[model samples]
Target: MNRILATARVQLAAWPSTLGMPWLVLGGAFLVNLMVFALINTSNEDAHTGGLVTFYVVVLVAYVVTMTQYFPMILGMSVTRRTFYLATCLMALVQSLGYGAVLTVLELVESATGGWGVSLPFFGVEFLQQSNVLLQLLAYAVPTLLVSSLGMFFGVTFKRWGVIGMYTLAIASLVVFGGLAVLVTWLRWWGAIGAWFADQSSLALLAGWPALLTLVLAAVNFLMLRRATP
Candidate 1:
């Protein structure tokens, strides 16, 4: 475990450690979330609709951005592709947990102050004090993992500066949901990347399928990684 962790750390350092990207993504997530909370509370119908857009956009950005950091870093390393995949998976889990922790705190504060209500599916977390903490965490985890796996695939395919694809995915997700708002719907091709994090039902089904898919995809990544000339 320590070796893997150490390896992961070393690999991470090889890339630019500027706080710029991390801050940009995290700040964007929080800012978009705040807007959603405000919008949903508004009585305006437009606000309500806007809130949904906000929600999907934030989820897309958060998932893609968090996973983006790990993908290329893994490939840039001298490690085996399997090891790289495992490392990316572990990193993704940790990143999701971190975001989940912060989001839970925000939901609680909102519920208590009547600022903006946050709810969870598995548990009825309508109020700050009554919110289902575990449920809240899992709710966030759904999209996080979904984005991570999909982002990993992107990263494995495009090593250096691959995070650019994450940004593209985020923008594309925003466009899809936004387009749907106009009632002029089209095929959601790129949003499937966002689907890793934006699934609305049957989380167990979602998780099981994505996890299996990630393994298969990661195996492919491993093969590609082995053949990749460093």
Candidate 2:
């Protein structure tokens, strides 16, 4: 147990420089939240909806970037997969909770100030159970797991994290984003979080499925790493 946490701590400390990126990302996200509160013209409900969608997309992107940084680091490190995966998810969600709080407060302030009213995502176990929360989460997590797993595979295969990160990002961008845009354009999700979002009921029943899937992929990649050893 102690060793699991120790491994997580080591993963956290491994990148002293990338540590601040989350803070910077959160700060920028907060500012955008404030701006949407203050500047957006919201004379109608659709305007409000648009503003909220914008907020969702921005936060999603922030999570992806943060996850991108920490995900690969954890994947590449010599640590227990359980420790690495849980720690990264906890840290990422903690940061998301903070961002959500700031946005929630700003939304209230905007309403008070007669600006566009927006509701930030609430934090807590309740929020986690909301309709497609799992979907929303896995929307980000799917691509993350894929990229992180592939990155580890390539990094271990080639013995170079940077090269792997670069090429993987490029390929992932070309494929994932491209597919999503086309899909969402051709078939809108109504209130759904696009096709990438998983069903919460399904996800809840299959607790640890994400971690289980990630672990299996990681193990497969680890096997590759071992076999490639000279």
**For candidate 2, lDDT tens digit of each residue in 109-219?**
544555433333211122332244444454333433444444444444444345575587579889998898788778866447733344645444333455566567667
Clashes of 2: 1
**Cα miss at 216, model 2 (Å)?**
4.5
Give a tens-digit lDDT track for model 1, residues 1-230: 76568666754563333223443555565566566655555543222222222333444444344335544454565555566556656765776677566656765675565444432111113321223677566555545566556655554445533457458767888998787755533565556746854664444443456556756765665565555433
Inter-residue clash pairs, candidate 2: 135-198
Residue ranges of candidate 2 with Cα displaced over 4 Å: 14-20, 47-216, 225-230
| Residue 85 local lDDT, model 2 | 47
In model 2, what is the error at residue 229, expressed in angstroms?
A: 7.1
TM-score of structure candidate 2: 0.41
